[model samples]
Target: MQAVILAAGKCTRFWPLNEKHKSLFRIMGRPLISFCLENLKRAGLKEVIIVQGKKRDIENELKKEKISGLKIRYVIQEKPLGTGHALKTAYSYLKEKILVLNGDDYYGAQEFKKVLSFFPSILVKEEKDPTSFGVIVPQKNYVKEIAEKSKKPPSNLVNAGCYFIPKSILKEKIKKSSRREYEITDYLRKLAKKEKLAFFKAKEWSPLSYCWNLFDIKEILIKSLKREIKGIVESNCQIKGRVFVEQGTIIKSSSHIEGPVYIGKNCQIGPNCCIKPGSVIGDNCRVGQAVEIKNTILGANNKVSHLSYLGDSIVEEGANLGAGTIIANLRFDKEKIKTVVNGKIVETKRKKFGSVFGKGVQTGINVSIMPGVLIGREAVIGPHTLVKENIKEGTAFYSHFAGFKKEKKRI
Candidate 1:
């Protein structure tokens, strides 16, 4: 069987951090996609086709890793069309059976094994919020019907976007969706009517759909981190729990790190610093003295100076957080943090969600950012200000919540 990995998504929900399709993001020196691909390789699958857009990051990474002998190839999805159109483009190359999956989600080996057994099946999982997705109505382990956004789903098995399509379906010449685009859901719905489609429940799965999803991945990585010191530790440091200190990183005396925490290569955790669980300091990062980071993800080359608290936030590459800065992850009233997406306040389902910043963002000293705020690429925040809303790309926003000045003279 062949595998068709659909990576053509624009990843709009992830916003600033995923402005580009960098699906192969590294987790502890290994690309995230690598983890998925290796699973397929170990399962003895040789042919894998990756559907991508104009961006060649995925293809380039495959070459950089010298991943050959698997008949790995790429198909260009010229337009930002639906997933159905993407699979149609790869029809000519598909043979007897094809495994369709999203590139951003991680499905365990056992799940793939089930797919290999049931060649024409859709992997689903029971979810509380099935209305947000195309849900499946199954009867006795077989899919009865699929209702897209059904107010009352017959079942809670939401489509995980992993399908085992037979070659016969490709010969049917399925038509495009109503929006003038082809979607995989339409094809599957048609197939479900014609033949009995098997369904398997997911044993382990994770979706990289939102900005906070990185926190889920971080927690997964921290659990796998080895509790050994590969790097040098200067005297006066206090390290506990399961911490993975990569070689060339330094923890100066007066620094305290509590794991499940991961420090990337060549990083510096200085004196009087405290890093808590789910904290990932990327390569060449510096956590200065008196800084505290908890449940945060700092991308490469970030510098968090002294007297800073980065909690439950995502700091992109080359970001510099000034001293005395604070990232408020929780609200004053303690409600679920909601982010404005496409003029809609979408609930993040997270009580503590800090800002999501793109690369090259800079903030002045004493800056304070509210929960669920998103700062665009290269945006700047002036010192002693509070950012309560989103900042546009490359724009500088500054506001002091001291007091509003009254207009004395009317012109």
Candidate 2:
């Protein structure tokens, strides 16, 4: 069997990080889509057709991996349409029964095995809020109807977006929904009445529609990473638990590193630093003395050669952190961290979460940022700056405490 991975839609919700394709985002030094592809290869689905849009980042990434046993192809979605249109973009390539999966979601191996067991199956998961997913109304071992984000869903079982459908399903004429786009589930809904649509329950599902969810995804991927140490661990360093240090990475003496952490290749860690659990530092990252990095994901080539405290944050590629930089990761009343999304307050539901910095962002000394703040790509934060809100892309923020008046030198 083959799989058609959907990588088209514009991930606008995943801002800052959205500058790049979400599937291209790295977790534990690997792309998100690579995880899904690995499981598919193991499940005996060797051929894959990826439906993508605009950018060729996903296609470019696959070329570098050169993953064996997985034959890959790409089809352009051209315009931003619905999932149905995205699938249709690769209609010419669907010669056999295929498995369709969302490229951005992390569907583990267990879920893939279940989907392959049933023919014409749609994998569903039990969700707390079914508003985001297409709720499946089940009848015995098959689906009766699928309500796409209805006001009140029939059941809590929602569509996991992985489908196993025969080629005949593609023959159904695509109809546009109220949103003015074709929906794949609408076609599946039509088939449900005439035929019994097989169903499979997914054990794990992760929706990466929000940028804050990066922390949770990072934590999940890190727990499964094998503990390997190829870097230089100087004497007197307390390295506890499962830690993977890539080649050329150095853990300077006297640093305390708690486990389930990954230090990427050529990373320069400190002589006096505390790398807390769930911290993933990418390649060529430089961390100086007395820096404390807790539960965070630092992208490739980030520099923190300064006294700083980064807790529960996601820093994008090439970010430069200055001395005395502090990221506040909690609210005063201990409530959930809520951020401003399109001028509206959106609760993150995370007890401890920090700011998200985009690529090439730089900060001066003594910069303090509040929780849930998102700094966009190529942005700059000046010295003694206090950030309490989100900053857009290419913005430069500076602090001015005193008025510039050459009045008497105050001598």
Candidate 3:
């Protein structure tokens, strides 16, 4: 069976990190979609169609990767309609049975193979809070109904966005839901009523619905990595656990690294620094002296200056953190950190989520960013500034006279 991956969403909820498609977000020096494509290839699927946004960014990014023997065709979804509309845009290309998946989610090859074993099947996972997703009601081996984001969900088995369905379902016209957007679950609900829509429970599912979800994905990816070192580890440096250091990277003397950590190519780790576990440092990054990086994803070409502490954060490409900068990842009361997403205050359910730095972001010396703050792309934070809220794109934020006077200038 052929596969269709839905990647056309605007991802407004993933702001500050949504400069590109969510699938293009990298883990372990490769885009997340590349991993999904590789998994699909391993599942013995040769033909794949990707439904991407009008910008064609996902296609452009995926073209750089060499997933041999997988023939990928890109279909454009010009509008910001829901999943049903996105899938409908690729309907003309559907032939025979189709395996559908969400581009932003991580699924294993075994899960794909399991779903493909049954005809007209929907992959479901038992979730604690089913209200956030489309919960599936099962009748024997088939799906009875699908409730989309219902306050009173019938069951905890939620739709995992992987479906093995016949092409005849694509021919049926789908109506817009109450949200005024076409939903794929509506088609599933109709199918459950008329026919036996088979259901398969997935072994694992990692959906990147929010920015902090990256942490969970990172942890999952890092666990599968084996220890390999091609870089220079100087004497007096202490390395422990499963650490993968790429070529041309140097771990200087007096530095300590505890892994489940990945250091990419050409990175210069400090002579005196601490890299704690669950940290992935990308290529061409500079983690200088007296810096302590813990459980953070440092993108390529980033510079973490001396005396800085970045913990539980995601610093995107080309960001430079000035000296003595500290990112606070926890609150005084230790409650779950709440972040503003699309003007709504949403709890992160994580007590230690640091700020998210967008691409090319620059911070001055002694900058202090609070927990869960999102600094937009190319934004500048002046020295001695304490950032507590979200900063918009291209903004220049500064404070004077011990932060008594605050200013925001759009760059």
Candidate 4:
């Protein structure tokens, strides 16, 4: 059996998260898609086909982590088509049974094993929002109807987007979906007419559709890190609990690090900083003096200087937060925060949703970003600004209360 990893989606919903592909984002110091590839290899899969776009970042990373036995093949998703079109592009090598999945989401190994055992089947899961996903109405134990975003869904069992299809089924013509793209769900709709599509329940799943979705599994994954130290630690640094410090990371003096935390490679933790549980600092990151990072995932090369409070947010790579930059993760009313993804308001279901900054973005000193605000890619927030809403890409926003006061004096 072969696995087709669909890594070609441009991930436009994740604005300010860089133009690079989403699968290339690292988790615990490893590329996200590599985890899926590694699992496929571990499951005795030899031929793994990864469909990528023109972006070479994902392709380069795959070359860096070359496995011995797996025959890695890269196919280009030429145009911005739907998932069904992507599968059609890789049809030449898809022999026997094929396992298909999205690259950004992680489908667990055990679930993959179950799907593999029940080949030529579709996997479904019970979700809270059935309309937000492709839903499957089941009859007895088999899939009866696969509906694409039913406003009134018959059942909560959603299509998890993991399909186990035989080579014979790949020949059907997938109709163009209402979204103006070829969809695999169209074929599955046809498949349900004749064959009883075997349904398997998905135990674990997560979709990376928006910025705050990064925090969905934060606490669970941070604790699962291997508590081993490979980095240099100063004698004055206080380290406690189950902390996993990857290679090239350094803990400076008087910095208190509590466990259930993962510090990635080449990171520098401060002289007088405090890092609490559920903190995942990525590679080459810097946490400076009097700073506190709690239950946050800082992407690579992010620098949080002195007198800052960063909590419960996903800061993308190459972002810089200046001194006294306090990210307001919680609302004054203490309600769950929401964000706009693809022009739709999505309730994050998390109270703590700090600002999400894109790559190479900078925040000036004393910046206060309100809870759940999204700053776009390459955008800059001027010093002392109180950001209340989303910032568009490549723009700079500055809040000037002093200027307003000066004008009032003239009036």
Candidate 5:
């Protein structure tokens, strides 16, 4: 059997972090799509086809990984049409029964095997809010209908974006949806009406629909981690629980590391810092003295300077947090944190979500970022600045005794 992964969509909803393909987002130093590919390979599918956008960023990123024994092929979609268009673009390469999956989501190998056990099936999961997903209506053992984000959903079971279908399904013509793009759900709906589609309930589904979803995926990945200390831990440091320290990393004295934590290669930890559980520091990162990191993910080369407090936040690669930088993660009211996405306010569903910093974001000393704020790539925050809103890419934010100011970045 062959597998096709649809990865060509322009994930605009995942702003700030959407600088690259959404699947390229890393968890535990591995891309999310790489996990999907590994699961597919374990499910007995050796030949895989990836449908990527014209930029081919997904293909380029995967080339850095050392994946063996899988015959991987890439197909360019050329345009941002839709999932249906992406599937059609790869139709010439697909043969026999094909397992289709969404590249941005993560599924377990057992889930893939269960879906493959029932051919011509769509994997569905029970979700509390089906309005955001394609709700499935079942009849007996087959799928009765597939409704896409209907206000009054027929069932709570939603499409899990994994399908086992024949190659001939791609030949059927699908009209453009109201969103002006062809959707793959149209073909599934047609198959449901013909009573040829079956339904399989998925046991696990980790989707990256929003930025905060990264925390959820991180928690999921950390569960499988065991204690493997490959670095040098000073005598005074207190290491607890399951911690994975990579090569060339050093934990300085007096630092307290609570685990289920992952420290990537060649990193420098603190001499008097407290690294709480669920924290992941990427390669070449630095966590300086008196820093308290809790449930935060720091990407490659990030520098959390001395006396900084980063909790429940995600800092992308190459960001420099100056001394005394504080990221507030909770609201005074103790309610769910809300963030602006695509110019609209959306609930993060997390009560403790700190700011998300894009790549190369530089924060000056004594900078304080409010909860749910998203700083864009290459942005600069001047010293003593109290950021309360989202900062656009390449913008400079500063505050003085007179008032706050926003200007185009000079550096």
Candidate 6:
């Protein structure tokens, strides 16, 4: 049996962070697709088919990794259609039995095993908000009916985008959806009427559909990491709990770490720095003196040097945070932080959500950013500025907010 990984997504939501496909987005020093493939590897399946678009960014990485003799194949989806159309593109490479999965999602081994246990089943899980997803109607462990967004769903069980299907599905006629795209759920719903579609309820599913999903995914990845200190720990350093310090990483004097935290290869963590739990600092990064990083995901080569506090944030690759910079994770009201995505207020559903800085972003000294803000790629944030809104990609901002005693223009 083989697997079909759907990766050809025309992504726009993961802005600044993704100039390319979302599958190529790095998480914990690995691309998002890497985790999915790793889960497939853990599930004991070797042969694979990946459907991607023009760039083939994922293909390049997979080839470079050379995943230990893993037989891999790729198909280009010229048109940016829905999942149903993507699966159709892999018709030439389909096997007698295949597991169809989303490429950007990171599912655990236990759930994949459950889906594989049933050859003709669809993996599903109970979601809190089923209206936004394809809801499943189960009857005696088999899928009775599948509905996409009803006023009232039959059940809370939603599609986790993992399916066990025959190769003959490629021959089925799929009609275009109302949105002018072909959806796999519609095809599966129709398929359920004529054939057997078993259902397996999964216990864990971590989807990377939005930016906020990274926080939970990062925490899950960090927690499962084993403790290994491959780097140098200087004197007067306090290491509590399990921490994975990769090779060439050096923790200087007077730094304290509370783990399940990870420091990637060649990282330079400094003196008087406090790295709290659930933090993952990537390769060649620098965390300088008097800095505190709490549960933040600092990408490779980022520099947060001196007197900075990063809490529950995501700083992409090659970012530079100047001294005395602070990213506030909590709102004054303490309510769930909401970010405006494409002029729509999308709730992050996080009470302690910090800002997301894209690749190569630079900040001047003493910059302060509000919660749920997004700074674009290669953007420049000037000194003593207060960021209250999103910054566009490749833009430079130098605005500051200060209340004047009288009616006057503020910085």
Q: Check candidate 5 and list the clashing pairs.
A: none
Model 2, position 76: C-alpha lDDT score: 91
List lDDT for all candidates, in order. Answer: 0.83, 0.87, 0.90, 0.81, 0.90, 0.86
TM-scores for all candidates? 0.93, 0.95, 0.96, 0.93, 0.96, 0.95
Clashes of 2: 0
Worst 10 residues of 1 by lDDT: 22-31
What would the per-residue lDDT of candidate 4 be over residues 1-411, giving only the tens digit for each residue?
Answer: 688988888888876574778777766877777767777777767888888887756788878875677787889988978888888888887887788888788666777887787756888888876876878888988888987776888789988888888767767877677788988888787778868788899876677777566665455456467678899888788888889999998888888989889998998898888998888888999888889998888888999989999888778889888999998889889899988766777787887778788777889999988888888877888998888888888788988574433345554
- Per-candidate clashes come to 4, 0, 0, 1, 0, 0
- Cα distance off (Å), candidate 6, residue 233: 0.8
| All models, RMSD in angstroms | 3.9, 1.9, 4.6, 3.1, 4.7, 3.5
* Native-to-model Cα distance after best TM-score fit, residue 45 in candidate 5, in Å: 1.2
**Which ten contiguous residues of candidate 5 have the minimum total lDDT?**
187-196
158-256: candidate 3 lDDT, tens digit per residue: 899999887777667787888889988877777777778898898767888988899988987897888898999998999999999999999999999
Candidate 5 steric clashes: 0
lDDT of 2 by residue, 1-411 (tens): 789999998898788888878888876677888988998988888899999887878998878875788889988998877998898889887976889998888888778889888777889989887876678888998999988787688999988899888767878886788888888897788778778799888876677878887776676677687888999989899998999999999999899999999999999999899999999998889998989999999999999856899999999888999998999999999988988766777778898989999899999999999999989999999999999999999999998798776677766
Backbone clashes in candidate 1 total 4
Model 5: how far is 155 from its true place, Å? Answer: 1.2
- Over 237-269, each residue of candidate 1 has an lDDT whose tens digit, in order, gives 889998889889989888888988888899888
- In model 3, the runs with Cα more than 4 Å from the true position are 402-411
Candidate 4 local accuracy as lDDT? 0.81
Q: Any runs in candidate 4 off by more than 4 Å, and if so which?
A: 217-220, 235-237, 401-411
